[model samples]
Target: MQNQSLTIKKEKILTGDRATGQLHLGHFVGSLQQRTALQHQYEQTILVADLQGLTDNGHNPHKVSSNILNVVADYLAVGIDPQKTTICLQSAIPALSELTMYYSNLVSVARLQRNPTVKNEIAGKSFGSSIPTGFLTYPISQAADITAFKATLIPVGDDQLPMIEQTNEIVRKLNYIAQDDILVECRPLLSKVSRLPSSDGKSKMSKSMGNCILLDSSERDISKAVKSMYTDPSHLRVEDPGKVEGNVVFTYLDAFHPDAAYVHELKARYQQGGLGDGTTKKILEECLQEILKPIRERRKTFISDKSQLIEILRSGSQKSQEESNQVLNSVKNAFGLNFFQL
Candidate 1:
C-alpha cells in the first residue's frame, strides 16, 4: 500500500470529475492521467462531484449516483492508487456546502456571467434562458471544494483556467477583507495535450454526444469506436491528397502515439497525396486499443466484485471527512463563526 502522507511540498490538491457518465479517452489524456501522477507527489483529494452533477442533471440523481461508481472505477482502473489519494463524494461532505454559502456572497452574479468558461458551457448546453441557479453559482461551489481541502494546485485542461482564476480571485478577496489568509491561492497545472474531440471530430467528446470510448469498454467496442472515427472528407480515393489537419485520426496519433518521429513522417506522407485515410485510421485504432487494454482489464476485475468497490468508496469518504473537518474548523476560527464557543 502506498503511504497516506505523500510529500506534498506546498499544500494539498483538490481535483475531481462530475459524475455525469463514464470517463472516456478525452478524460484520460487530459486530466486523469496527470492526476494519477500527482498522487505520488501531493496530498491528493479526488471528489466525486455529485453536488456539481446536480447543476445540470438535477432530475437524474439516480443516474448521477450510478455513474459515481463508474467514475470511481475509471479512476481506479487508470492507476490512481486509493491508498495514496483521498477520494470523497462531494454531497457526502457538508463542509463544502457551508464553505460555498460563504464564498457565494463574496462573488457577484455579474462576475460569474462574465466567466468565459461558464458562458461557453451555458451556450454549449443551450441554457439560454433557463440556466439553473446552481449551475450559475457552480464556480463558487468549486471555490468551496478547493478551499475545503486547502488545495494549492488544481490540475485542469487549458480551457478550465478561467475557473481556477475565479477561485483565486475569491480566495484573495475573502482573505483581504477578513484580514486573514484563510483560503490558499490555487494555480492551474495545465495539461500539455488538449482534450480529445468526439469520434465524429465535431466537438469535444462528451457523454451526451454519444461519441465517447469509455475506459471500461470492451476491446471490441474500442476498436469499433475508433474505426468509425471521422477523417478528412475530401480524401475520397486512397491515393488522393489527404489533409492531416483537423483529421481525427491524425489528431489521436498526435496526442497518444509514442513514436513522435513516425507520426510526423505519417503526417508528411498524408499531406503529400500518397497516404490513405483508411490506413491512417487503422493505425490510430490499433494504437488506441493497445493503450486501452490494461485499463479495460482492470475495470473488468473491479466490476467482478461490487462489494470491494463499495468498500473502497466508503473508506475513502471517511478519510476525506477527517481532513476536511480540520480545514473547516480553521475557516470557522478565521471568520469567528465557531458555533460551540471553543
Candidate 2:
C-alpha cells in the first residue's frame, strides 16, 4: 500500500494545534492522521500555535512554552514527517501578528460578536459577556494564520466549520475592500470520524477532564484507562445484554479500529448478551496499543533529541517567515500601505 501510487491535484494546507497540552487519541484521529496522509500530496504547514495559545493562556506563558515541545512531540509521534511538512512555531512569525492587527480594523466588534464560532466558544468556556478581547477575536487571528501562508485547505473537525466560513468571509471582505484577492480563502477538510467520546462518557475529551488517553501513556496505563472506560451502565452482568449507544468503547472502535467485520461481530455479541464489558475493553486496549506503540516509541526518540527538535522548529520558522513576508507584502501593496517614504 505504501508503494502504490495515486495521482491527484494538490493544494496547500495549513492545520495545527494550540500548544495547550499534550495531545491525545482524539487529536490523532481527528486531525493528525489526515495531516500525515496529506503531507506528501500537498504543500503543508503544521503550526504549533503558541501565539494563539496566548489568547487564553496569557497568564501562563510557561504553560504554553512547556507545551510547545510537548505538542511538537505529539506531531512527531503521530508521523507528521517534518521533511515533508513545514513545522512552524506561530509566534516566531512576526508578520502574522502584524497582519492580524490590520485585519482587526477591517472587522467590527459587532461583526466579531456575530461570529458563530466565537459565540459558541465563548459560551462553552462560560466567558459570557466578558470574553477576553484576544479570545473574542481569535477567528481573525486564525484568518491571519491561514492567509499568512495562503493556505487553501484547512482540515478541521465538524464543529469548526464555522471557522472556515469566518475565514472566507474575511477573505472576501479583504479582497473587496483592497480590490485584490491578496488573502486566499480556505475550505474545510472534515474528518470521517465522529467526535471522540471521553473515557468517562463525558461530552468532550479535554485535558482538564482527566478522561483523555495521552499519546505517551504506558501499556499499563492504557490498560487501566480502558478498564475504567465508560460503557453501558445497565451492562452490570456479562449476560445482561448491553447497549452500544453512547458507549465509549464502541465509539472508540468505530473511530480507530480498522477491522469493521470483527467490530460488528463484537457489538452484536455484546448487545445479544454473553460478551463482557471487560472482554470488550481488553479488545480496545489491544487495538489501541497496536496504533499507539509505534507513536510512543517515535515520541521517545523525539524527546531524547530535544535540541535537534528545537533546531527543526527554528529552520521551519525561518522558512515560514519567508512565505509570510511575501503574503504580507502583497496585502500591504493591495491596500496601498507599502510605500516606505509616505
Candidate 3:
C-alpha cells in the first residue's frame, strides 16, 4: 500500500487565466507574481483556460485560440518556470471536461444563479435576461478543474471567493452521496493586492477597454499608458494641491513601487501642492518600465521560438492528464460508473 503520510505532506496548487488576452500588470499584482513565488513550494499547475474563455467568447473562437500562445508567452516571460510549474491547456485535458459534465449534475440552476461572482459578471457584460448557459455554469467547470487535480490550494482574487465556496459545496455533496472521499475541497489564497484598476482609472483593467499595460508592452507603450493614467481631475496646476484618493497613478505606485518612503514622500508632496502630474506620471512611468523591461526581453526570446512553446504546453498537458485521470477513475469507481477498469 502507498504511504499515506507521504501523500499528506504534498501540497498541490491549481490556478490560471482565461485565454482571451495577454496578461497585464493587474495580473502580475493580482496573482502571477504570487504563483511564481509559490511554484517551488507546491506542486503547481497553471491552466490556460481556453474552455472558460469560450464561455463568453463562443462566437469569436479565433480570439481565444489566437491568444493561447500569447498567454503562455506572458507566463514564461513573467518567470513562471516551465521546469517548476506545469502549464497546461484546459481543453487539452479531456478528463476535466468529463468531470465537469458529472459535477454539473450535482449542482442546481438556482444555486449557480445565486453565485455572486457569476451574477456580477453577467450584469457587467449586460447579458441581463439573456445569459449564456455556459457562462452561467462556468463555476461548475471551474470546480471540475480544481477537483480533477485534487488541488489543496487555489490562488484567486477576493471576487472569486464565491466560486471557491461553490466548488467546496459540490465536493461535499458528491462525497456525501457516494459515501466516499473521492474529491477534495480547495482553499482560496486571496491575493494580497486585491485588484488593479485600469490606467484610465476604471474599476478593473480590461484588454477590451484598451486601458491595460500588457506584460509584454514595449517601453513606449508603457510610457503612453502611464502618461494617460488618471490623476486628481481638479488639480490643473503644478502648485495646486491634488487629491490622492481615487488617483490611479498613486494606486499603481503603492502596488509596484519598491521604495515605500519615496512613494510616501511623493504622496505628501502632491497633497501639499508642489508636485505636478507630469512629474508624478514620469515617476510612475519609470517605475513601470523598470519592472517590465526584463519581462519584455524574456518574452521576446520565447515568442521567437513557437515550436518550443508548443512542446512545453504539450508536455505539461500530458502530465496534467495523467494526474487528473487517476482522480476521475476514483470518482467513477465511487459512483459505480467504472464499467471497464483498465
TM-score winner among the candidates?
3
Q: Summarize candidate 3's per-residue lDDT along 37-148 as a digit string, tens digits.
A: 9997888999999999999889899989999999999999999999999999999999999988888888889999899999899888998787888999999999999999
lDDT of 1 by residue, 85-107 (tens): 88778988888888888788889
Q: What is the lDDT of candidate 1?
A: 0.86
lDDT rank, highest first? 3, 2, 1
Candidate 2: worst 10 consecutive residues by lDDT? Answer: 1-10
Superposed model 3: Cα runs more than 4 Å off:
1-8
Superposed model 2: Cα runs more than 4 Å off: 1-9
Q: Give the best candidate by lDDT.
A: 3
Tens-place lDDT digits, model 2, residues 1-342: 554444444589999988889998888888888988999889999889998887887877887898888888888888888899999999999999988988888888998888787787777788656667999889889999999999999998888888888888888888997887778888989988737878888777776466788999899888888988899999999998999999999998888889999999999999999999988988899999999899999999998889978988999999999999998887787677989935
Look at candidate 1 and give me any clashing residue pairs. none
lDDT of 3: 0.92
Score each candidate by Cα lDDT: 0.86, 0.88, 0.92
RMSD values for the candidates in order, in angstroms, are 2.8, 3.2, 2.5
Query: Model 2 reaches what TM-score against the true structure?
Result: 0.94
C-alpha TM-scores of all predictions: 0.94, 0.94, 0.95
Order by TM-score, highest first: 3, 2, 1
Q: What's the CA error at residue 156 for candidate 1, in Å?
A: 0.8
Question: Worst ten-residue run, lDDT, model 1?
Answer: 2-11
Measured with C-alpha atoms, the lDDT of residue 104 in candidate 2 is 87
